[model samples]
Target: MKLKQLSVALFTAATLTAGSNSKADTITTPEVITKTTSAFFNCADYEVVGVCFWLYCTITGCTVKTSAKVAHYNPEITTQTYRNAEKPPWVETRVMLDAMQAGHDGSLIGIILETMGSGLDELGGGAGSENKAASHSNMTFTLTDSFGNPVLLASKVIGSSGYVCDPQLTPMYPYYVSNLDTVAWRFSIPEMFYPQSLNPFGSLLGSNSYNWGGYYPRIGHVTNHDLVKESGLIAFRSAHFLSRRGESHVYTTIAQNSREGFWPPGPLTEHSGKWQQLAPKGETSCKTFPLSAGTGPSDGLSGYRSDDGAHVWNLWRRYKCCKDRGDFLYDIEW
Candidate 1:
């Protein structure tokens, strides 16, 4: 019943609902405005009646948003960050191949990671009303622990520019890599971690003190570390939650549960060749997404970029290495 593993009926209904309301959450720096009052002027505002009110709010130092302010994207979840606080549970982060984007390279598989964590058995804390709930994050954000003090993240992905968590995720969306030391990427949760709600993605994570973004994957790294310096802040971004309207964003909400290890897409098993579970790869768009650097064909797909000299092939939703043009080995006829 989880968002990722929802029944087809629920999934279709939810997707429909979400598609209608999904809009980017933009956060901008408060604009600087000079209030002015005159015979025919008011303060400009969100809801404009005339020039009178505009000048009033401006004179009161309450003018509406000003163009002088810089635009900042908050990516706020707006609501519903299901964190596990009663008992801080250790989560799992794994890498798997997205067969949906597979090709002759045996399905380009690398460290595109996803973490699974737990949530409240029920809507505990003030979850029912505007997220006034005191859940794991709100409770422990100030308290110091092994991972040191944690910061509340409204969205799963670190929006702080220039900061990258796992290279598999940022700087480049993870793609096909061969025989690499994939062991460098593993993460878990600590006893006291940040619980964020109203975040872009309803993820619970333990971030490092640097807060700017991330640390490179290192060798001999343990899956779950006891110190922030060792582990850094890890996120469970793939979890999903059921919405009150019976609709939910596919990979943003998580199930309020009593236990952990609830795979975002369901339990997956590794087979000799590929993973044996059916999970829609999170963020599985082709290489055309902005900031994408891969070895896709130059003329392949729109918005898709070719390799950055990394020798990596970029398949912009096309799985075949070469599309058949029906120009078989037949003799050429004019």
Candidate 2:
């Protein structure tokens, strides 16, 4: 029989076994059954067959082995966090973005989900090992409608964070790099229309230190130096992606600070070491304008610009307290 037909038949047989239990009254041995019909019999079904046979011998009822091997099945459903394998509810993504835009001030939502795999080099020694080490997790953002639905964002790959020798940098610098120019991969989502405004700089604006009394220092402060200036948009790098695939592919990072923003620079900044404004007053729209004659190469990051020449970052920052409270920043659907 065809594979599809076989699958259906196996499922039907299993269902029949469950229903047949009420019809049998007594139990019997397997030896009394001499007629072999199907070649599917196995030792595992001895107990089930014995039960049915005994019932037949004692009550003159039918004796047929109904157990069948069937394929295992699982359905995608939404869970509380992206870390969970199950798909989140359809509305979860939208609710998350709304909460973030309204409460977080436009900060990009950083998610550190499961890793793709381990990267332990068997041939590399001390220096080579350090140069080839992996990161800890991968990351993705949620674009929802107030209810969760997977929405795609425009992004590009960038270099990894440069190497540092300080012990304080170990936690954030989970991966090794041979050079400084290797673009650390991150997703750059430009400013899109949201009903509420997000607080992109709240984390840096509110905190005095990187650590909020935890075993590890806050990752946001460790990864980006611009946070101190509080002048640029935020962008997150996923530890999960770095750890699993290195910095060659597209992925995101999670930021530990809850008050930072992750968007790109505005028009007032210097394109070539001189300040220039690109928008009019009270305008908050992102337009596809051509680069100026002397403008430097585009950095391939995403953000928003205001008419007054102010730019914001779009990196996702996480609060330790918010995680324990079941208030996730974003969710994903299959």
Candidate 3:
């Protein structure tokens, strides 16, 4: 049983009873962080699969299919910094929508977008050039009702300032996003196991190189080539591991260009040494460094050394860098 199939089955059983309010209208579980769990399913078990708003929903009997958009945030930088000092020069926000399915069992859909409004004014000065509007990212979950109408399940707001490290400005103390709120309703699915299933409702897909917090040197590298050039070295890989516990982390490798071939491979050359270092070889911990325009001290090294001199490597947790024109590699191990 794949996650999508299980979700559809649960949805069908829950809604089978006729009533003025659909079973989905009410959440039986309390809204607590611990209550959220990853649901699994097998696509081979279902005849049809659908996704919406990054939520995977599958139907065994119905043919209705829907698409969804997974929103993303675009941050504008006025200036760039490699350290925790300078303030970011300019800031802007953009949104992206991706396709999703609604049938995945125990699957959840959410959106992330950077927004500007009164929320910025509350930070300090009124909306002015000097006091640019504070940017926000909103993650929303969506689902379909008994009638198959697309509906929003839940939403949460996150601030941009806290996540990025600036070189100049004093670090904002206790960085926090002020209007923190959660949607009253959330989608629910059945419990099942599914593998190699297409989760249209979730933003991260096998085709995408970057995971939740893992960074990619460029965007197009994972989704398309054109966008690759526009992507900056991963400032940081988002903490996807924590968000989706129990779910196996997937890593994809890119072929090394001629320039990359010249560099000495790291200890984990078998698995793209650089990626192993960033993601690590085990389930305990995974971390990657911030990427800069030029190579740093750790440039070109095939493996990463822990503080104790332990060399741990894996392709899934590696990162690559470039010098004048050659290739450099870095690994993340714990």
Each model's Cα RMSD: 26.1, 29.5, 25.5
How many clashes in each structure?
A: 26, 61, 77
lDDT of each: 0.17, 0.18, 0.18
lDDT string for model 1 (28-141, tens) is: 011000001110021111121111111113344543221111111111111111121221110110111112223223322222221122222221112112344563221111
Give the TM-score (vs. native) of candidate 2. Answer: 0.15
Ten contiguous residues with the weakest lDDT in model 3: 89-98
Candidate 2 weakest lDDT stretch, 10 residues = 146-155
Q: How high a TM-score does candidate 1 get?
A: 0.17
Name the best candidate (by TM-score): 1
Candidate 2 wrong stretches, greater than 4 Å? 1-218, 222-233, 236-245, 248-334
Per-residue alpha-carbon lDDT of candidate 2 for residues 1-334, written as tens digits (9 for 90 to 100) = 6432443343334333432222121111110011111111321121111110111222654443221111110000011111111222112122222332322112221211112121321211111112245743222211111100010000111101111001111111112210111112111221112111143333332133431111011111122212112122111112222223332433222112222111111111111011111111111112112111111224322222222222211111111110111112332211
> Against the hidden reference, what TM-scores do the models get?
0.17, 0.15, 0.16
Residue 157's lDDT in candidate 2: 13
The C-alpha local distance difference test score for the whole of candidate 2 amounts to: 0.18
